[model samples]
Every structure is written in structure tokens, then in C-alpha cells.
Target: MFTSRERSLGKLVVERFRKRRAERINNLMVKEGAYWYDNFITRTSLLEGLSLLIPGLKFGEDVNDFRDLGNSNYRALLRALDKLDDHELQFFKTFINSHFYVCHATNNPAIATKKDMVLFSRRKLIEQDIKFNTYNTAYVDIAGLANDDNVFFSLEIGARPQKTIPGAGGSRFGNTYYKVAYTDPSFDFSSLYLFDQALMDIPQCKISDISEEAKAILNSRKYTRKSICFYGRKSLPALALSIISATRLLPERDRLVLLGCRTEKEKKRTAALSF
Candidate 1:
């Protein structure tokens, strides 16, 4: 397994710093306004400070969509950030980007309330630690087997979600969509993860050390810290992966890439494509 911390931070290249600024900016998305009313901003001037100190960081031109976020919260976020000095801004940036929030739903998949999202994220992280460490360090969401309409009916009300216990073939099918985010406060998994930390980031893992054989067997080379698809939005690519990617995941394209790189670590299909 590899992480951002293992990656080289040599010379503090401007490009890497740019990427960190991008990641920090993204984190602020969830910290503004009504979302803030619920999630709240624990780190006030963190982002503004990071933007000012980082040579490459600068706010982009006013965006049409970001405009929808209401100028007030954006301004509030910016104003709070304006209060910090350079060095303090650097510290705030570093500290704010280090934390990870899990995105999850409770027994309810229709809506992931903020409190429920928080709870689910925390518990899921601990659970993921166990599951990911198990299975030879492999984790799979085998939702394929659980994808029958009849199964849903049965599981929830018919016979699919039947057994209140673990066995299947019961009399009901239950709503089973779940999601969460997990993090390693220390970039112990990969050097790349660590570099992101230095840059004030929530770095994504690029690849793990699985054998080529394992890659060939699974027909996929990735696992994740979070996913693009949650609840009824499997069709929605992980928008947080990129501002553009989120726009794409809108109910528009069918050729969407699954946005489940788990924050940033990607599973590459190392083998060549064949007809």
C-alpha cells in the first residue's frame, strides 16, 4: 500500500503546490452556508491563508456555478481567511486539509442527513480499516449480486431483504445503499499522500502494490476511500474528484466513469484493452 506521505516533496515544485491549493479549495465547498449551518466551518481562515501564501494559488474568475453558492458564504469564508497572517495561514491550511469526512447514509439511503453522514463516515472508516486490511488487502463492493429488482422487493418487503439475520432467501429486501470516507491522518500508505499533506491537501492515492497477477484477475486495479455513486446516484460520478467531473455526472452522460477512487487513489487497469 502507498500514500501521499511517501511521495517526494523535493524542492516544493510549484505544480505540486498548485495541486494542493486545488484540493484545499475543494474542501471549502462543503464548508459554506446552509451546509455550513449543519456541517459548520471549524477552520475559519485556513483556505484564504493557503491561497495567499502559496505562490501558485489564486481565486479563479467568478464562476457561474459557484455563484449559485450565494456570495455571502463565499465572502464570509474569504473574510475569515483574510484575518490570518502568512505563517498562520500555512498552519491553518495544513491542519484543515489533513482531516477527511466520510460521506454516508444511515439505514436511510434517500437522504444522508449531516449528522448521519458524520456518524456513518466515522464508523465506516473503522470498518474499512478492517475490511481493507483483510482479503489480502483487497476490498470489493460486490453489489452486483445484490442488484435484482426482485431482490430489492424481497429484501425490503418481499423475500430478498428477508432474513433480519445474515442469511438470504428470506421474506424481504431492504434498502442497502451505503457510503463513507476514510482517512489516514499520517500519510503512511503512500509517499504521494504525504506530499499532498505538505501542500495542504487531501491527497488521493494513485495505486497500491498489488501484483500484476492480481490486477489481471480482478479486471480492475483500483479500490477507494470514497465513491462517486451513493444512494440512488451510482450514475453520478464522484463530482468532488473534479469540479468538471461533477458537472459531467449530472443526469447527462451514460458513459460516465465510476467516481469511486476513494478520494484520490486510483486503481489502474494495467493490462492492455483487447477486443
Candidate 2:
């Protein structure tokens, strides 16, 4: 387990890294006569919340330009100017100043398509997670019925703080305990997904950037006599490729779903990076 200090430091490191990434995007935008929105949360979502605080602002627009949408951009920019306790307003400023730009683009999609893509992507990911969880639950239930063994599950990942021996100094009471070692219990069944929210929160510097300890736990998992699946429906090509490759040494029955795409019809024209 990581100490509170360690967790705080980790969060700080991630925030700094993301801020640097944001700055890089901002530089690119400035060079190209565009601006970068650096908010982790999307602008439209923030606008939806702000609509409750402020009035007479229309959320629906053909062009989706905040500045042209009856002074929404100006109002948000003004609020951020206060630099008061409004973090949302600060983020709103970032979003507005960026010209609502994300990455470099010559021809952005229509507002409807953009909104549809966002909504569809979120819904598909959630549906995939639900299916994976259902499979995991069913596998455990069958195993328990056969062997009468208890199974436990947790959606959380990462280390938690534990108190160690009392500290020798003032102000501090005890040493922060760290989980130096990890072990994968003889889980009747095990599974992993590359695009899980917890793993997605990690920066992509390297696999190690996430956690060496968590990786060790994953690497230690045995697939023999158990069902261990890996999902990658939402991973980028390079990431999906790497994750799929890692599954080669696992048990043969362990399922691995890499990137896939289909353009069936107008409603479900799916396109994604694949390996």
C-alpha cells in the first residue's frame, strides 16, 4: 500500500505531466492561430452545469461556438477573471480560450456528429464493461457452486495507506506503510481490461508509469484452470497491440479482444484504430 504522502505525490506528478501536455497543445494551437482548451472535463458538460447558475444561455447551437452563442464565452471568461473560488469558471476559461479546439484539425466534424460520437463512445464502453462484469460474475458463481469456495470482487485498484511503527519526530505520529510485495491469490478466475477507468487514468509514458506493483500482480496471475480475459475495445492501436501481445503467454483459453470496427449502417458506422 502507498502512504498518503506517496499518493499525493503521485497525483501531483500526474497533474504536472498533464499540465505539460496541455501546454504543448496550447503551443501548437498558438503557432497555428488557434487556441487550446486545457480542461480535463469537456466544455459542453461544464456549460450544462453553468446553465443552472446563469440564465438565457442557449445550449443548442448549429456551429457550437461558445463566443457566438449569446455571450456565454464572455460570461465564463469574465468569471474566470475574478480568480475567486470558482474552479469550474477557471476551467470554463480554459475551454473558451482554446477556441474549443482539442487536437490539430483542418475540418472538424459537425456538432451533431461530435456529440453523437461522444455519447456513443461512452455508452459502448459502459456496455462492454457490464458484459465483462457479467461474465466474471457468472464464472465465479459456477466455480463456487462446483467447489463451494467463496469469491470476492473489488472494482478499485491502487494502494491504500496503512499505519506503520510510531514515528520518532514531532507532528508525525507513525511511519507510512508501503506494500513492497504483491501476490495474486489462487483466484478461481481472473480478468483484466486495458481500458478500464483506473488504468485509463494513468499517463502513457510507459507501462511502468501506471504501477510496477500492479503490473507485478497482473503478471503473477495464472490462467491455468481459470478464465482470465483481457479487453481492449477502447485502447489505441499501439496500446492495444502491446496488451494483446502480453496475453500470448497466458492460458490458451483466456480471451483477448483487440480493436475491431464495422460500418454496418448509417446509425452504427463504427471506426477505430486496430492492430
Candidate 3:
């Protein structure tokens, strides 16, 4: 088992890594003439397909043939993000990319209001902490199951989505997708931590205070302060991590004796593959 502190560190690491990765991908896509809000069919096809795959949003009627979102909430989101600095911009983008899956996963359209998109996107981070035991480890050959009619359903959605041959039960099947990201060197998870909001939001002025407090707590239990990373979640990735690693603030490490728990959950639903 790992401690909460350790788990938090691990999560922060992964969160930071993914954020950098997203920024890199975004820049690359832009360089290749891909914009997120553009009407370019092949470019925005992923979001378009998502709108179709999800239950609430209709193809043409609800979202203008998946080209334009009918709701003003997306515009509102753009406005909100427009005010952020580059550093905060990357952070927000990374944060949203991590939870954008939830937007489509919603079951109720009336309840799946535009506000719900942001709400679920923000809440999914905490939900991740409670659900999984993240580790600085790597996994290979990972596969999971999902249903065709479902939105980001878990791996245990039962049966294959479609059958290769026309048969009696072919219509009742679900889809089994492999975790290809795991195999990708760029999506490495070897140093990921159990994530929490605090790790992402902590301020620098409070770092020394927290470090002192942590030391006192550990000393009472015969533990010593080791190294600590005062990143506070704005840290950029290194060259080995991604091409955009140098775009953000560098990570800081401190020595402190941190304690936490490493929890383990059943391997029920595997990685989410909405592609």
C-alpha cells in the first residue's frame, strides 16, 4: 500500500505528463492545420463522431451535423478560457481533456445540459482518485469491453459490439477495444501518481508552511523529511517526456518523509477508448 501523499504525487506526475502531452499534440495538430473549433470534416471528425455516438446529442438537429454545437455554452467556455494566461491556458486545456470523456458519457440529455459538460469534466478528476490505485508502473497488452450504444461505458459492457459474420446473435454484441495508448512510448505511465486537486492547486507561499507541518508530523512518528516536489501542478514535462516539455514551468523536488496509501481496485472497466 502507498500513502495518500505518495499517491497524490503519483497522480500529479501523470496529470502533469498528460497535460504536456496534450499541449504537444495540440501544437502539432495546429501546425498540421487542425483547429479544435474548425468545421473541417476530417480534422474535427473525432468530436463529430462523439456527438453521434453519445445518446443525447443528435447528428444534424442537435449539433448542426456535428459541425457547430447548438448550445452557447461552448462559446461561454471559450470566453472563460480566453482570459487565462498561457500557463493557466495549458493547465485548463489539460484538465478539460482529461474529463471531456464524461461529457459524452452522460445518460440524460435534459440533465446533460451544457453546464453539465463542465461540471462533469471538473468532477471526474476527484472521481478518479476515489476509484483507482495509480502507480508509477507500466501495463501492456491491456484490453477491455464496451457497448456500441453506450457512451464511454466500462470494459464490462458485455459481448462484442458487432459481429464479422451475419449471425443470429450478431446484433446483440458489444465492442472490445485494446489499450493502445499503453503500448505507445509517449503515453508512458511509469511515473504516474494517484492524483488529487490539492497537488494541482497548491500555492508556493504555502509550500514551506506545509513542508514544516509535514516534517513535524513525520518526526512525531520517528520519520524524517526526504525530498519533496513543490511543483503545485504547473510544472512542465522534461525532454524525455514530450516535445512541449519546455513550454511550462519546470518541476521542483524537495526531500520530505511523505506517507500515503496505495489502494487497489478490481480490474473491471479498463481504459476508456471512445475513438
Steric clashes per prediction: 45, 3, 26
Clashes of 3: 26
lDDT of 1 by residue, 89-125 (tens): 4433332243232221124233445644222222243
Candidate 2, 96: how far from true, in Å? 16
What TM value does model 1 have? 0.18
Superposed by TM-score, candidate 2 places the C-alpha of residue 182 at a distance from the truth, in angstroms, of 32
Runs of candidate 2 with Cα error greater than 4 angstroms are 34-275
User: By TM-score, highest first, what's the ranking?
Assistant: 3, 1, 2
**Per-residue CA lDDT of candidate 3, range 120-177, in tens?**
2222434544332222111110100011111221212223232232254321112222
What is the C-alpha lDDT profile of model 2 across 155-214, one tens digit per residue? 121243222343532113113222211122211122222332111222222222224443
Q: Which candidate's lDDT is highest? A: 2
Q: What is the lDDT of residue 255 in candidate 3?
A: 19
Report the C-alpha displacement of residue 180, candidate 3, in angstroms: 11
Estimate TM-scores for all models.
0.18, 0.17, 0.21
